[model samples]
Target: MRDFMDYVLTAFHHKTGWNVDNSYASLTTTANNLLDFNVPHGLSLHVSSLSSPNFATSYTLGSKGVVDGSLSFLYTSLGLNVTSRSSHIPLANLVRGYRHLQHLSLPKGKALNDVQDGGTSIAGDGRKDTLLYGRLYLPSSSLEALYLRRLSPNRLLRLNCVSDATLPSGGTVLALLQNDFGKYTTEYLYSTDSSLLGFRALYNFGYDPRYPLDQQHVSSRPARHPWDHQNGRLSAGAEAYFSPINKSGGISTGLRFTTLPIHTGFPYTMTLTLNPLMGNLSSSYAVKAGPNLSLCSRFDFNVYSYESDVSLGLELWQLSRPRVPEEVAWVKDLIRPGWEPKVAPEKVVPDEDVTGVLKARMTDKGKVGVVWECRLKELLVTLGAGLDLKKRDSVVGKFGLEVAYSS
Candidate 1:
């Protein structure tokens, strides 16, 4: 009986190990991508070169006759961008931080390439490697730089600086340190802009020791319990921030529950967050309705202000089939004794098998948005539109087209 119980427990751990941990701030990433991505409102163009895959440029002309453009260079470890207008901070890097730690002690020749390609192999227990990454953004002559490094398999460090000519202090700096354990993760943050200090941590209630965020251990066994395979993971996290100069502070907490799509099972993710200091509550749910369809919804309420909002969004994929000619050479041979059609075969697109995606969102405040993105052989296209239901007098709303070409 004891041997049987140990086997059952090992099977359960295998099921939970299939999923990885999520950062505390990434609880709403799925919902936000579907409902909050910006919609283009005019003509836009982007071009890139295959020989120089790391470089690209874009230009946009809005409905209000405003023109803007940007040049960007992206690589595995370095990035740079210059634009006419400033934009928000990068949420994936700054807010969400690292999802996992990587320990690499590969040979010098293949170490960099392996890391870039996400290749894993047998190595020593600890990492004898050092990695440094940097990104720079220049908007309207202002400069912002971000740098990151891994101190060890369980620790990471990051620094960010923003410089503007008009600022009284000329610039501000922010720093972050992160540590990951098998069952939980923690982060510390400090910002010179506001003299703020922050701490955040996330813990998995059903965390499996075999598969931590770093994914150092893997198994090939199947789950004995079907229910355990479907209920992937559950996690809870909290964050608090305080400013010494202002003598103020705030705290927030959140929970996330998610399932894996195993053996054609429909999977879903749900998240709830509460900010007691602000009297705010928010929740979101995203589900894969079918093979080609996804749906998501979000709700927000402010208990003190008595304000509430709700939104829904969906994504659908469409695929086009190759066309067959009605009158082929073989078919024409039957009609004429010795005649063949002079027409040549249709040129097939190399990427004809590619599928297009359409996304739409609607809010309780009478705002609706639609976006369609598709790819041709060497070109990509995006169309977007937004409508205000309350404004009946306007026959049309905002719409835009964006095109990109690559060699």
Candidate 2:
């Protein structure tokens, strides 16, 4: 395992002008037990200074930049079975400091029950299983970010055909099953900038939407089957800041519009904004209004409504960061003159055997869209309401609130 890891590290250094190091020897015995490794586990760390002269700060100049890659492997044997697991985390950053990051990856593997007991047949035969997981995080700032994750689990089973097999009535069976889950999210925010119109756009795509806010909810049936399904969603919106611009202690206002697309539908959309500090404080006056629309089966419907959201809160400090430098350089290099990266062309293969065909058809459709948002100091709140105008009309509403500490 150590020799294999060294080979990997050497390859990375040869391909990219970056230094690689390892701390596997420093790993404690307890950590090894956690991984169920009888032998000591290996660890490696890579570091490359951006200030190095040999390192190309920008890829646009056809320069080899700094890169970091690490991998870990472990193998263990318990009573009657052995397990193996590994993890690989790789990051590539531009030599020249850029606010954004170019590439980041986290990959993991796990294998359980490599071998099972044959003599003792319980309710079900013990099976072997393997899990693969990965996640990527890119946060440009508090207001802008992108995230992606994927997971797959595979199982192998062996079963006896009959409960009591005195005769040849029992048969042996082997089965294999696999499940997959994934998610992608991106968001951008513009904070009342005078030069550019205040705007924000948020998009979320995933195989499963049930766990919109939970990051760990990878599979759908965690308690029972513990497998997730294919689900995805995309939503985007923009807002303009207005009123009380120069005033320090008075009211403020803004305008907003957004659209959401989930499943096989046109879009559920809404537009609205509000102002709280401008009017009377004692009998606070608020205004909320927006147009709503929905489309299904190529049909479109629209509606308009008015509502208000009131809240009291405090102010806090806001921090922001720039985009990943390496990614920026990569984009620049892609547009540079005489710069080209060779990419192998894909081979076209035809399916010779005929199998069952599948088709998808859309029938009934509906949409309801309404949105309202307000923030007071440390507290933030939003409300959305819509109606599906189809053969069967339905109403939908969601409420969300958030609080943060202020300085």
Candidate 3:
């Protein structure tokens, strides 16, 4: 039971660990291809592939690069990007500072990677950054503090404080304070009767001030109304228990309300657990302004709306090997005696089939579409169509076909 409703199931008895493969490397190449088109203003794309894979490690390296618009005078951009992993640490000799009693991110693998990467990161006028973070935790005193500094990319500092206290009445209270040398955010949480009931509050002092003032809370104090012009924005909710702990399911409800401009809603959610079948449902009231964001079932809609991107995803595992076509078998037999093609049965991506639409989006309005894709060996075929839902005009319908080759 993790917060944010993120639950993962793992088999402790599996013979092999989870596979993390070259999918990320392939994605990096695809992203680089996309960057080659529609150049951003004051930016130029390099012809060479910047997202090259790092073969140095047992696995592929994670690569990222940036184009400096400020250095327009040079024909080429400054080298300000790096590809590294946690275990690849460098520059251990340059660290300075001492606090043995506190938690320190002093030397170790992280320091090594930062040192090696920092020197090569000369892309923009922004100086490279070397981080030094430390923390002191005292459980007996129920107190904690943290400090972090950036030696490069301009001097930057952050501070953190926390405290947790347990009352004789079997209750616990928590407080946290964090500041990044600019604004500060504070949070307080209280649990009564051993977490049967809980409450939390947050105040953000350094929020953006450009938003229109909340006329409803204009008279409220700064503590209650942290954002300018915004009235008191408070949220409260409750949890009810059902079934046995860890062996059953439960339900919970919450709400967030603001005084002025009239914004209020009840957040409803539930967890369904039944043997091998499990899922969670949730609702939010935030409006989505871009296609990249998922549409909220309740808030992302109005009287008139355009939802161009509808998607259906399908994946197949435990595939049955397809028999070679008769014609292909005949050709293979003619080439040699008992000739057969090779296959990597252990590869997650089976060789039986492949093909896809490559890419699609809701680039048009008032249209509904269906797409079908199949994979055959290293080739993928995709066929799809879109029809105007508002009208059945056959001539206005659209159909598309795409084929992809991969190895």
Candidate 4:
């Protein structure tokens, strides 16, 4: 019965699809954890899906809380993606006190507009692509500015593979190793013929000196000449600026330029991002509001196309946090004694905080949307709605109910 319910819920969740930024009838939504379950067996499931009018369906799944190894798969309207991941491989585990991780992803799908004559039939066969990623940590000591270093495939640990007569299948794509200096850093990635050089400085980035999470630069050129001097994709921009301890809100900006022989449609582009967080707490309730906004501009060297959007999200965290009792009981009457407002959320997982986010979004074209999410014990519920001023847009939405018996 549990398995049957799990299947039904899985299918329903897949069919409805919700978004973390904006979900449900303006009620409750979770940020990072959309759907998560830990089974007694060695398997865990983490699923998140989103769908809107005119846009293709997308599904993403990530494994969490696993102690040792890793494996993941993702499917979309375009095609299928598979990944092999591990932290303690045979090679990396030989040395004690040294921890490392590696990941490789392969995706298969059709081209941008590979449609047939009659209609747009679903086809999953197109191009084959692969990306390899890895990171290693070394001991830190007196004479090492390169402590906890990295040697990834590319500057960003991703590469594009193409079959050709001029290039070998598996030699070396690109190699990068970064050096860290207090309040600043420098890096140099190179091969026999190609090289990339870069540098940066900051005040109080507060990054995990050992394992920095914000290492991926979306708008920066490391190699004076990109991979093989063939793919000319480079960007120059300012690094992210973080705020003080009191308020953790800041702004990031970037500019990217590409020089390719075939495409003259888009030459350069610029982006700006803002992230702000506001917190509220009382004796009985906790609320949090964090909004992320972004604006982008594209210049073809002659004409310019600009766009912008904003997502406003709020979360209701706890309801008077329950008190721990000496003896725990799974089955108890919801109403005990004097009860004006009958009952509160049950204590299924003791001391675990329950969170729900309600958010809204507005596009540059005057389309508005709202979403809500809530949690009652182990059950999750979400709903959403949308409206367009022009009355021609499709209002993609999610509304659902779920019930289960712990057998």
Q: TM-scores, in order shown?
A: 0.67, 0.18, 0.22, 0.27
Model 1 residue 205 CA deviation (Å) reads 1.9
RMSD of each: 14.7, 28.2, 25.7, 24.4
Q: Pick the candidate with the highest lDDT.
A: 1
lDDT of 1 by residue, 1-407 (tens): 01111122222222222112445766667777678856767886755332322233333232436655544332322222222111121111111111121121111222222221234433433432232223333345565555544454455566877777787689888898876554577889999966999999888665354243234323344444322233356779999999998999999999987664222235567889999999999999887665456788999999999999999998765647654432244345657876632322222222334356788899999899988876554556678899899899973488888765543
What tens-digit string does per-residue lDDT give for candidate 3 at 7-54?
000110011111111111111121112111111122121111113121
Cα deviation of 176, candidate 1, in Å:
2.4
Residue-level lDDT of model 2, residues 1-407, one tens digit each, is: 12222233233332322211101111111111111111111222222111221111111011113332322221112111111111111111100000111111111112222211222213322322221111111121111111111111112111112122332333222121211111222122222322121222222233232233245454554322112232222222222333344433322232212221111222122212233533321111111111111111121122222222232211111113322322234446667899743221211111111111111112234333333322333322223333345635334322222221111
Clashes, model 3: 17
Candidate with the larger lDDT of 1 and 2: 1
Clashes of 1: 0
Question: Candidate 2 overall Cα lDDT vs. reference?
Answer: 0.22
Tell me the lDDT of model 4 at 394. Answer: 53
Show model 1 residue runs off by greater than 4 Å.
Answer: 1-21, 49-64, 75-139, 166-168, 210-230, 321-352, 394-397
